[model samples]
Target chain A: MITEQHILSAFDRDLESVQAMIMKMGGLVEAALSDAAAALETQDEALAEQVRKGDAAIDALEESVNAECARLIALRGPIAGDLRTVLTVMKIATALERSGDYAKNLAKRALVLGQLAPIPGAAGAIRRLARQVGLLLKDALDAFIARDAGLAEDVRQRDLEVDQMYNALFREFLTFMMEDPRNITACMHLHFIAKNIERVGDHATTIAEQVIYLTTGTLPGGDRPKADLTVEGQ
Target chain B: MITEQHILSAFDRDLESVQAMIMKMGGLVEAALSDAAAALETQDEALAEQVRKGDAAIDALEESVNAECARLIALRGPIAGDLRTVLTVMKIATALERSGDYAKNLAKRALVLGQLAPIPGAAGAIRRLARQVGLLLKDALDAFIARDAGLAEDVRQRDLEVDQMYNALFREFLTFMMEDPRNITACMHLHFIAKNIERVGDHATTIAEQVIYLTTGTLPGGDRPKADLTVEGQ
Candidate 1:
């Protein structure tokens, strides 16, 4: 007895709810990235633990987003643009969930680094790097909400700076290790932590691409520029 | 008007082609992992280049699989079990493509490591770890093809072995770097290579989880056992 219009309205409601969930997940990841960076700078073990614990919520939200997306696809049978929108939302959720994992990892390394003697300038450099990636993620999410491909492309371009920052941090960690053998373990942890944060930047860039694709129905041609060829992360 | 049976058969054909692509992608990844290990052991720059170049094909396959899955979801509007099957194939393809990326990363590191003097036994240890993960991927793909959740669960359990192997390699690299300051750069590259390979195992296990979910309609309760908590990958 249901009319086509009723079903169409139902689809719209489902899509709206799912999109809201994506934004919510993005907000949580942004907070986690920034908070984890602050915790590292301050050597706040309690804050780090909280970041680690909060990852579960992000994971749960991702699962819900994915499930809701799948349900929308199967039930509504959206074609063309609506299908692309659902697919984009699912992809964004996956990327955000991974960024959350990396933030949690940075927090884990921060806790370990807290017990060691402060490496000159390491924590501050790491915090700066984290802030850059956090802002990149925030912009990407805003672009998604605004449906602004230009903003998304701008966010994509910004990742080159993040890569340069990560490379500099990598060399500094290497120098610290070479300067003092005692610095080896701490520096190694720091190196991985920086790598993890760089990965968060990579995720942010990927989210931007998703936004571009959703808006334009095509992925940007050619590779996004990379300052370093070092391959790490998904 | 087209018969419902005709639509069903068309869906089957599309799915069959997509699943074949998944297997092909999986095969390429498995070979890439093994070859990358051999290239590292023999310091064969040519083989490493081959692995890197081969990744483009895997990326193409992933794109094709994703597009085909999206098309099926839209045109065929597969519901319930059929929808789940298509979703599973898409997820497995994603895992395989990431596994391919890690293999390519291993090759990149091999090229770097070839420039430096070998760390004692590092090549053999890494090759062994790569082989373990390779075997794990083989089983995961087999599970996908055979619809064998039991096999998938077995693969899941075996990741613990991969984790333990990687942990041992991490410590060995640390010891090597500490023993000789000159060894630091080479060991850092090796540590990341081993970590990348370990991530290949993680992706393989993720493929296994997707297979399990398809067969049983549930993700395994709780976290998969992780040997070490040093977070390093997506």
Candidate 2:
């Protein structure tokens, strides 16, 4: 019986270690999003380069988390809820990795945008959008650690705000391009950057959804409300 | 000893079931891509709607595959190569699901584009790109099923062709927008649709990477060459 207790404790420790790794990965992604936004706002090529380089770390961490999850399952053979938690961790890591990729893509575009004249207010709007997404990501990860379904739902709802901001920026960029053809090139790059940020929000929502599923044993119903009416009339 | 053989056979059967489901899911995604492109080329709204609705089945298959993987792991406790195969199945299903979403997005855009005047040869370009992506997806999945690392590497390399086509399309769309403002909206939508196709190719490459990792037990080293210079520099 003592040996059984020891085995259970070791399993718990393994699960905690996976959670810790996920938090570490989440932190890297958060930094990537923030640094990517800051680099875009300041047009800092070096910082943008840093954001791009940082992605490899996030990708590596995701692989580590995945390997650990598989190892835990194979060794301990966790059942039901414990199994779900490990699977959720793997899913969340993938979402974070993709979010990191989007940030890297944004930073890459920022480096290109640095060469051209900025469209007025574009950088500020992008920074705001990025900030919102970063916060949602943090909240989603917190909800996962705390097992707080309510907070996860809140993060899911907040994604609509990100989408709305993206839509506003989409229209704003279109107006800028229509007003002056010179703004076209810069606006297009900004649009792609904004789209990338919006994708980060979507990934955050995915994490939130996974959290809810982990806690509730069922996914949330109904389609997520999307406000990014960029291509309307679907 | 007889029971051990029975257990091993059951594990093998479970793994085979997951692989079969993945192939079924891949077929749906390939169809989605082709139908989306054909709808865009022919401006068939009905076909576009059908493609949009068809995504639900792909999504359902992904859920089934995930559940099966979790159950197999918990019940059978597959280890080493078997565990990796199951994990790869889940990852591949996810990539396929995202590819389906992109195809659905393209179909939605196709519905919109059907209302407007056709851009000369843009539909053909999109169709060709979609066909290439579809082929890549097929090869990637086949490689996964066959454990053919060489074929997986070929699929990885073919993604570059999709990216190059996307770059060329980007330049073409820019020319169209610069020549006439009337083309801006259509071209923007078309550009997005083409971007979706390119993204499908990326997901295909992701599956190929997973296949290579599954077969060889090591991810391919160095970054996958990206030829999509849409956001160049830094």
Candidate 3:
């Protein structure tokens, strides 16, 4: 018969494996985000295609993480903190997968925008936004690995900056579109790319929130501050 | 000592209760979508506020469902198909919660747009799109309750129509903004509202996909046939 200690060790090993996969998935997502932003900045269609293709791997990792999570829960019957950790791993994988999708979308838009006249300053602003989101995602993953709720909260707070950047870009795009209708098509695509980057930040915040919940057993109180003034009156 | 049959029956009862909660949550989301669209069509600020306020209930229900799913998993130790069902329930609750948020966003935008000049045919098109998405959400939940994969696939396919409608509206809004800059601010808000409704359809499709995966151990393949031409040629 299998001993109790053996089962406990196996569960710990399983948990570590899942966590490792999540980190691997996070790495791929970070790379995709950077590449997508770089592709946009340089108007590199080939690099954009690479980011789009890379999404499938991230998606497959999510599927594996989900299966492993379900398997661990079924076979080990984890409770309390261990259970929360497993569930959080699943949630983090989901957030990472979504971030990957947003990156893919940005890359897809970059490919089309490459064919059009470049919008001055828009690509640079998008790259900065993507970099900020990348930093937030890195901190979110690190917090998850360390179970540091404070660091996770820090990541969550930074998302407000991302929203502000997105709102600024929104106004800038409106100005570009108004200056010349010829810029409208290109500006609209850039606006979407900016929006996609903002969404990546939101996903990063979601991962951070999951970490906070996993650590504290309670979500952060009140709504996270929203700095996106695009629809402020509403 | 508890017999095997006792544990099995208890698990069944737990599953039934979670499913009931999911149905209730779905009902609230459907109502919110309808009301948000109605408010936009009639420029009814009071109705919009009602839809916005109603979102809290949907969110609360989602929290309850998540807690119950965790409890069921910990207490019952469900495996294989039962485990998938529990996970799918949690996912469906999340999708429903997101749909509620989108509906709330639509209502919020409607409140702002009510003060602006009406965009010709835009409000009516949005209402029709919302109605179709509401129908899709209804069918997705029904498929979940009945374990009907075919119906879920049908819901998944219908999402393409929602995307097509959204793309058409995008062009219409672009025309309005180009013809008169006075319509720019209103059209931008309308564009966002339409985008939110399109996101609602996406969430409904996600729920349907989860239902398909729950019923059949495999997700439907081939990229789900997106019809959104906004970012086409990527």
Candidate 4:
């Protein structure tokens, strides 16, 4: 004999399992990003290659997460707030999978950049950007788990700092390219890595936005201030 | 007073309304891409600005689609195939919205590239690529509406051609940049535009894949081949 309470507890357990998979995916993405940044700085082809291979795992995790979410919706028939929670998880998984791809891209470029002469201070600058975005992602996931709308909004504001850092790096790379024609190839590659990190910051902000929406039932009103000079609102 | 048959018919009508919004959004995205491509070829700053400002409508449409899908799910409690169809609409909206953003980014770059002397033949090549991707998006939406798995699979294959075109253009831009230091800035910008189109092609492929999934209840077997050089497997 099954009571309503049994079904409710089972749904809770299922949601917890799915949410744990999301956290696991988030952890994998974070490690990939930080590791890719470190590989770029050290020109470690091996580490970079490892990061590239690891992306398949992230991709698999996202697939599992999506399948699980769809199943939960179909089986549980969750309504209102529960439905919003499920949808938000699906959106976050998409963002995380994309960020993982960016990390893989950085690794591929790192392999290429490893063969070339290291640009002075360029990798360090990119690492700083990566670290900042990593913290943004870490905190966004934290906010999601805690359902802390305030902390999520804080993460949203911090993306502007990431954007500013990216701008500074972009100008620096352009200067390097202009100063020495020989640096053009390296600078171009470095510019892309910086841009990738900047986009990752945007994804982190997206996660924060999703968390806020999940908790508050509405997206933030004011436009998240954009300082990414070139790419123009994307 | 409503019978079971009436309730079933109402669900069908609601679904048709939501899908109609998707087609409308698709049409807007296609126009934005083609117009941006044209603006690039002619260096029409005014036209480019129009495209940039027009992205808001696409974004709004996507938001509306999502909201309506959520409402339908909550109110109707759709299950099985109906649930998958609604979810696919949401996914397609996301792809269309992102493609629209890419078009807007192209316009933004076109504004900058206008001040600089045009790179010989680059704009024409990009236009051709955009046109190919535009056709892909059109066909993908058609596949979705008709529930034609074959057409969806066809659209998936066509993206490889877009990737090949991108690789050719990438090499062309690299040669232009290497031949003259003066061309580096213009070439870099052109490269990004080409890259964006390749991504648009990917989004179309995503839509096509979603269609197959919705129709067949399983993802297509094997990985779709990729040929874009430099951005390896992105």
| Candidate 2, A11-121: lDDT as tens digits | 999999999999999999999999999999988889999999989999999999999999998888898998989899999999999999999999999888888888999
TM-scores for chain A, candidates in order? 0.94, 0.97, 0.97, 0.96
DockQ measured for candidate 1: 0.45
Backbone clashes under 3 angstroms, per model: 0, 0, 0, 0
Report the error of model 1 at residue B10, Å. Answer: 2.6
- Give the alpha carbon lDDT tens digit for every residue of A1-234 in model 3: 569889899999999999999999999999999999999999888999999999999999999999999999999999888888888798888789888989998998998898899888888899999999999999999999999999999998899989988998999988888787777778778877887789889888989989899989898887776787776653
How do the residues B119-183 of candidate 1 rate in per-residue lDDT, one tens digit apiece?
A: 98999999999999999999998998898999999999999999989888888888888888889
> What tens digits encode model 4's per-residue C-alpha lDDT throughout B54-160?
99999999989988988888888888898889888998998999899899989999988887778999999999999999999999999999999999999998999
* Reference interface contacts recovered per candidate: 0.43, 0.59, 0.49, 0.29
The CA lDDT at A194 in model 2 is: 89
Candidates' RMSD to native: 2.8, 1.2, 1.7, 2.4
Score candidate 4 by lDDT: 0.89
DockQ (C-alpha) of model 2?
A: 0.61
Which scores higher on TM-score, 3 or 4?
Answer: 3
Ranking by TM-score: 2, 3, 1, 4
User: Which clashing pairs does model 2 show?
Assistant: none
Off by over 4 Å in 2: none
Of models 1 and 4, which has the larger DockQ? 1
